[model samples]
Target chain A: MTMTDTNRQWRLKRFVQPDEILGEEHYELSESPMPTIDDEQILVKTLLLGTSPAQRMYVTEERTFHIAVEIGEVMSGRGVGVVMESKHPDFEAGEIIQATLGWQDYVALTPDDKSDTGKNVRTVQKVPNPVRPLTTIMGLFGQLAFSAYVGIIEVGQVKEGDVVLVSSAAGGVGSVACQLARIQGASKVVGIAGGQEKCDWLVEQGLCDSAIDYKKPGQDLAAAIGEHCPDGADVYLDNVGGAMLDAALQNIAVGARVVICGMISTEYMNPRPDGPKHYFNLLYKRSRMEGFFVFDYVPRWPEFEEQLREWYSQGKLKLVDDVFDGLPSAPRALGSLFTGGHTGGCVIRVADDPENIPAI
Target chain B: MTMTDTNRQWRLKRFVQPDEILGEEHYELSESPMPTIDDEQILVKTLLLGTSPAQRMYVTEERTFHIAVEIGEVMSGRGVGVVMESKHPDFEAGEIIQATLGWQDYVALTPDDKSDTGKNVRTVQKVPNPVRPLTTIMGLFGQLAFSAYVGIIEVGQVKEGDVVLVSSAAGGVGSVACQLARIQGASKVVGIAGGQEKCDWLVEQGLCDSAIDYKKPGQDLAAAIGEHCPDGADVYLDNVGGAMLDAALQNIAVGARVVICGMISTEYMNPRPDGPKHYFNLLYKRSRMEGFFVFDYVPRWPEFEEQLREWYSQGKLKLVDDVFDGLPSAPRALGSLFTGGHTGGCVIRVADDPENIPAI
Candidate 1:
């Protein structure tokens, strides 16, 4: 069978101003020759694409740990896909994989490429023992799940009888974090989300002991948290860091653990917003606020994967996947993360996996 | 020998507005009968009164961990005094003891009373083996030293080759912290202070590798810190937590530890100032900012005391005592802490130690 002649890609056309919307003006859709693989490489067919707030940092002119997504280049991101053709021994043509698959439908990954430097850092690996509903690879067993593990288990160190609070609790990582906190023996898991719908879903699905709809105008954030967590939060997994973080700070118990996973609230500001005005509460309560990157824990992903799989099999965990239709919907999927459009793990369904493997 | 007929006391008359000076208007000089000790209590003759910025909190109407200092009450404080007479077995005449002696010449410390509650909380104890220049007991080997121990060795976790930065580095806690960070094997210890004199003193005394005079007109604090800590600060011991904290946050290295010992810069403000604006750097650098109270580590004071004494005896540490004369100077000494007027541990020399004790 002959593959399509041209590759479709969403290239970052220019660095968007923080005040500007990340739309087609900043990103351009382009068609190019399909990427050719070498003897030690594999060509991947993208299946599912994950969207994260951190992606906003990639398109900025300022450089972070990874290089900025350059103008006229494929926007870098993580995704789940299947190996279409492989010249590498570790990967077969039908095997599923997850890596920095970027914005293209197809990607040529060199399994033996050791030159991941400044501007060229790619993490392409074959998925081991593929899970059913392959989106689980990106939503639960992949980077998203790994980040939640790092924040909940490592950073927050949630323990039995601890009152755990999570902000943006209906979002991708927040959803998994709430479940993980419960599985780790937290006596009370409280969630804070934007709308009543997401908040209702959190409590109804038993993901949290209670949920507070922060967008409910006239409702005080700290007061609501105090009402739900009578003893105050022992571990606060903060994804949205603005007024919500300030509120979390106010309701934290003495020696509370505040895990700064993401600051989605201030990510789009031109000159960053004023910091959490209640940060001094950290001093008053003798609490700790810490931040981390999931990449630091990449070496231990296998351990996290195994534990997550066990939790899933025992019916103690659920992956709330909110998948958009096709590759063209990827940008909107990413945009929706900022607009609070999705309830759980927001991902774009790129294409269907080959039917050679037996369905679960 | 018969002492004076009356006891001199400074009573809190009213809560001073943030803009007003903590002067005679806020306090009233009063005379009262010397406190009588019960059979289980010891009579203490106050010798050295230590003044701290935390005293401002005591005068506030707002209650925190401790109750507010009420009007007509003797100003609450910590001091070193001699046991004038003792009915309690734990104390003896001529022995130096540390306790919440308040702003009075005499204090009745009930060593065996054990009825300390609410506004009567007294942390009274006999000074073990008494370090020389007895002022050292209240300065370096007392709570000041304990705070530095917690900030430098415990919270900041200063280690070999770590570049440690400190704010208000000329004051009591910060001065000791600078030395402790160096003794803990920090390769570079930088300090930020007001005026050229204190900055020069820090470098001349080898207390800091370099010093930034924050009060220097038009100097960009972040740029100053960046220039001093070329590789960025590995640990930041924050005492003056306002703009200096924001600057420190901006110049921290990846994985840096920020120890928030105090926020003297905003303590007297009726409405607290905005928090450190560069706090998001904690997320960007994957760092940690933690706070601790010295009282929390009281059980470990023996360890800290032993180490501090050893360093003092070995000439590795020095107590930069900024002593004001007489009980009347206590309020000014406390006021100086916020005005950046004192170079070291500010204390009021209430009276001379008894001649029975040898002057070393």
Candidate 2:
């Protein structure tokens, strides 16, 4: 049965330029009625909404869109949905699918629609699973885990007993990488965080062996790196790539590998910061630096998902997620990122997945 | 017969800032007679002077001693000299050697010294080859060739028919990389230069299919990159890394490899230039960017040198040197680099190596 005015669709109002006004109004959530399913179209009921820093950038910043988003368009997002009714033979009622379903209660899709979600979207490709609750594809286990994995395994090529240095260690990505390095057999993992609290917790929780707080003014980063990693860093997973990258470069052991995952400092900059000029250190130490993105391994997701799932199942990998409540809370959740306020991965909980959310 | 002449040496008189007096003028060429040769030492007559950019910064500008070159210290350089006397086992009567012979006509050293070059030092490792001109080693065929080779083959991993982009294409490293890319089976090599003259010469010399003058104002770099490379670039050998690197990031084909050999623009700055902020492209394209030093591949020198020698012997890779005629010309020669005045490798010719220089 179709009901009109039962649910409202939240939409992106307009693209904001750098100097333009940031929107002050709430999302235009109009209680739109569900439509009749056509012969080719399947009706979808969204189970969970995905809200992220990326989503906010895609909506308000405009820089995220290679193609312009329409002013009155439905806000873009990905969601897990259950088919309530289906006219398409491929989809059946109660079957779950994931798609770019927007922030709404329901959606009708044709068989040939580009946004159609037929296959299982349970895990990010290359990002292993069972890492769900403590961490999963939804958080650092999925995305940032891959970044650290590629940085250490593929680019950095970590070996047994190797010292690994992670910057922004208390943050979503860095914390997962610290754990992953250990699971991958790194001898020691040294974390660089912004405060004493996170630093103390990272060591206490067994995620990292040692931690250093960078917030103390006049703190010597190189000395700290050297002190924490006496054997020197064989692999460096760089999340904040400014002065931290320079410190890593300076203290790198021979044949060291530096993996560039993200440079948050450079992102919001009107003009980027000047990198260190003494790159000759790469020559002196015979070390290597490489940059990576997790998305490229989409073709090999099944392998990673299964492997990480085993790790999660066995308690080898922890799924650490800072779960927020809903769509409207997205901005505040993301803003916490810049201040180093969250740990593990940050995700939004759309609904109580009675079957999946696990009644505690 | 020992010719007794006052031995002279240049020294950085006192500590000064980057733009301060680079020269102290009180170069006390030692008033004492020539130094006595030890059992392992060889005395070689230096005919010309070679100046390196790093030497200038070390002697006059840089204060932080990453690698300290103190005031009153004997200036260091790679000098080409003819061995007049050898108490050591390795040298022959009239053999030419490249050694750490400082900035002087004569430098005394033992056979075990790191810079005791009795053969062609193509890279960090010395490979003996008697048939080629001595100037080939002193000119573009030695250390610089190593820079180009490492950048293209080892770092860029350039394949047959791949489109390669070379920044500062007509400069020392770039010139060598251009020729090497062609020899290693690249289908197209586009050169990026600073002026119309250098661009024309690069194309005319067949080092590049075409040359782009980046100095031209209002040149839409992204458009230019797109236009020149109709298909995306497979290999990018970066020399100019600030904005050019930013543009190159946008035009990479999937699985593209970028070899960061030199950031010439940033090197000369007192403080380094702005680094690229939107580095997430590395993740988006699944492309790889690596920073390489020619010296790091010391063990693989034989493998690369053999290939380079074959390419040179077949006339596929041409080595060109822009020679400045005198000792005083060293400053001007170095200064010309920042202004993009030299079209190829800049070499200081203090003495006429008529036996070697005329062949090219």
Candidate 3:
């Protein structure tokens, strides 16, 4: 296969305001000559870019997460790509890989770079084997899935007979979390989503036993959670912080684990909103609330991936991807995370899988 | 010595309002006939009433904690007393014991009540050995010290080379928690207390390596904590909650453990203030925040007490009690917890140790 010489990229045009919703206006499209590889470097052609709610922090004026994207720089992101040219002995052309590929068509990577970020998932590595419908790599077995594995199983400690509650239930991490909780022996899986449509999708897709429509007029979140989890939720995975977290706190059982994987609700808010009002429940019920970054568990990613793959092959886990076609749709796809417009794991398809790649 | 035929007691006159400070006005002192023992029961004469910030919750209109006090009821409390008479084989006259004796000069106790409250520290038990300056039993070896133990050691998981922070550092649980963190080999202990005097006391008494006087005019608490814990606190034992907890949250180290021991700041308020805004740090730092009731560790109290006594005997721990003399001082002393009027573990001495009791 031949590679394109022209690279189209999205650059951060401006930082998001605290009160603003992320949209296409925050980014600008530009063109550049395809990147070239030096000795020991590999030239990669982007195939698909994954979108995370956390990516919003990259464009914030302040440094909110580990990495920041400067104005005029290619918006920082992660994606799957194929090595179109390789000067490194460990890599070969045609090999599929995943890394922090940014929102661009072509890039050069030095696999052995010693920067701190380089030591994390940001480092370039070839995808093991190859899978058709490349969106699976972005949605099921990639960073998003690893995050759900850590939040629901490791941190949330979902166990037999547990009643699990998940926020942003139809989103990438939350959707996987709901399933993992059930697979981990939860007696019931309850989800909180922004609208009736998303809530219905959560239950219909078998991700939740019941779903709370948080968008319903005058809905009392805590009461809604209580009605579903009368015995109290044994594990609560929170992706959208703010009132949702407070509501979950009110209904947590003794020794409940509140896993904070993300705070999409308050991420863009400067002088962030006041925290959960009922966090005191942590003490009252002798419960625990912990937060984690999936990146911190990179060393154990393989362990999580193996189990998740086993579950998937056994029909115990499901993959759902909300794919936006082409690099031009990148900005809108990322924004859809916060807008609650996506149905599952959100990804932008930059290119189709090469013919030589095998299906999983 | 002959016991008085009339018993003096304090009853809950009214529940407290959200914004009002606790004081004598919320209680009424009254006279009653001395209690008599029945089969398997004991009649005890109250020696001292140990005060806790949690006592304020007992008088709140809404039940915030496990046990509640209703209007016209003798206020519930824990205290050390002498076994004046016994109808059971296990007890004898002149033996010292501790139980939920309430705010009264005499109380009738049924040690094996089989009720939920009886399963906890509220169950009457003989003091292992009588100690002179009986306030020691009320402070160093009682529920307050047990709370500090569970918070700093079991929950906060304070360890060698760790920097620990304690809120309300001069109060009952905080004072002991500070010392426990030090004994657990914390590299540095920073305390938050209301006044310059209490802050000074925290450092002078060797309870903290340094103390932040939160009452200082224009004091920026988060900044103050950052100055003392430049690398961030590894363990934060929060007794006051509210803004103090938020400030501590802002300055926690990676993997920090925030132990919620109490929320004295908002306990009396009908509507609690918003939670710590910077709780998101829990995720950014990959930390954990947990809360516990010392009563939940009832099965392990003896294990905690053993280690505490060993520390006390070795002079690695110190006892500092702010004693209020006489039954009449009970209301004012309990109020002192909120007003920050006491310097150390607050206790009300209803009567002196009987002459026949031996000193430890």
Candidate 4:
């Protein structure tokens, strides 16, 4: 493959308003001469970019998140890339790896330099083996899956006979969490999603025993949850906070574990919404609610990857990606995370597999 | 001493309204023939009664609590009593004991008969080697102290060098929790109370390093907590929920443990108030919030009592009771818990120590 002389990129235009939908308007697309690698740097071409609800915080006007992107700087994101040229001994051309590739076609990375993203996973690292339809690497074996691992296995502690409930069930992390709960011997797995389609997709994919469509007309969330979980949820994995979290709290069983993985619904709202009205249940039921950042388990990522990869190879887990072709689709793809317009792992595919890489 | 043949009693007049204060009007005083002991039962005369904020839930019209008091039935409460007559081998006529004596002059108790009060501690048990002023048993070595122990030690996992915070800090359980945090090697302890007097009492009694008056006009609770706990609270024992819990949440350090012991602020309200608005901090700070019912620790009470007694004997702990004299003051004493009209462990003195009991 021949390398291009110019690189296309998207830069932050302004910070997002709390209630605003993140879209192309918040970013500007431009072209620049390809960047060159210095003595200890490597030139890498982006292959696929992952989208997360947390990305919106990086561009907020206030420093809401640890990692902030100033206006005019490249919009920050994580992605898989192929090393094109290496000035460092540790990396070689054609080596597949992952890092904070941002919203750009190519980047010059210093492997030993620490990332300011507040995420250790953003540090440049080599991908052991290349897999065909590389979305599998971004979906089943990437940061998204690690988040699911920590939230469901480590924090949620989903165990045998547990009745697990998951919010944002059709989203990337939620999808994996549902499956992990089942694999861990959950008696039942219930998923809550925004539309009938997503709900149907969840059950059809065997990701949940039952699915509750949150958008049902005049839906009474707490009542609906009670109907599905007559004995109450033994473990609740919350992705979309606000009302959904409150509803789950009302139906938790004794000694329930409520895992807070994300709060997409109210995270960006300037005046945040009220907390769960039924949090008092935590005391009534002798339960606990805990939150964690996947990055905090950086030292154990390898152990998590080993278990996840084993499950994938044994046909116990499957990769699900909603792929948007090309770098230009990045912003629109990210906006879909909050709009409920996409399912599975939302990702932007910037390029095809290199000639000699074997397809899985 | 002479035993009276007439018994004066207080019965429930009506269920309490959500927002109403518990007072004399809710109870009616009447006279009845003295209760008699059966073959396996014992008759006991009330000595002193202990009050807790949880009692309000027992009288709510909606059966909001596990143990409910029916209208016209004797009001439920726990107190210290002395046996007047015995029918079983384990007890003698002059033995002092603790049990659910209710709001009455005398009671017939079947020691082995299980209590339906949803509390094992309420079952009839001998007060070993009774101490004079017996208030010491209720304040420093009873259920109140047990609640504080579980919250700060077992649940909160407070360790040395930690900064601790307590709400309702001058109240029964809160007062004890502040001292436990110190004994556990906390570097600093801050207390939040309603009035300047209570605040001063907290620091003056050495229960807190500093105290915050939450009733200060136009006070921003979060700001006040931040000023006293500039580095953030590592362990927060919350007795009053609602807005106070929200304020504490805003000032928690990473990995902080917010123990929800009670939610007296909104517990009796028909329409409970919104939950803490800043609960999202549980995620932002990778923290945990847990709730526990003290009764769940019944099996371990003896263990807790042994340790608490050791501390009291070592002068590492002190008992503080806000006493109201006479059985006629029971209603008012219970009411003071909700009105913030009393500090320390609130208790009612029905009769003085028997002539033969030695003073401490």
Candidate 3 chain A TM-score vs. reference chain A: 0.96
- How much DockQ does model 2 earn? 0.32
> Which candidate would rank higher by TM-score, 1 or 4?
4
Ranked by lDDT, top first: 4, 3, 1, 2
Best by TM-score: 4
Which candidate do you rate higher for lDDT, 2 or 4?
4
Off by over 4 Å in 4: A115-118, A130-132, A355-360, B115-121, B355-360
lDDT of 4 by residue, A283-306 (tens): 889899999888888889878888
2 or 4, greater by TM-score: 4
Docking class for candidate 1: medium
lDDT digits (tens) for residues A184-279 of candidate 1: 999999999998998899999888989999999899889999999878899999898878898998898989999999988877786877777778
**Clash-forming residue pairs, model 3:** none
**Candidate 1 has which clashing residue pairs, if any?**
none
DockQ (C-alpha based) per candidate is 0.75, 0.32, 0.86, 0.85
| TM per candidate | 0.96, 0.81, 0.96, 0.97
- Candidate 3: tens digits of C-alpha lDDT, residues B37-72: 899999999988999877887888877567889899
The iRMS of the candidates, in order, is 0.9, 3.7, 0.6, 0.6
Cα misplacement distance, residue A285 of candidate 3 (Å)? 2.3
Misplaced by over 4 Å in model 1 are A118-121, A356-360, B65-67, B114-121, B356-360
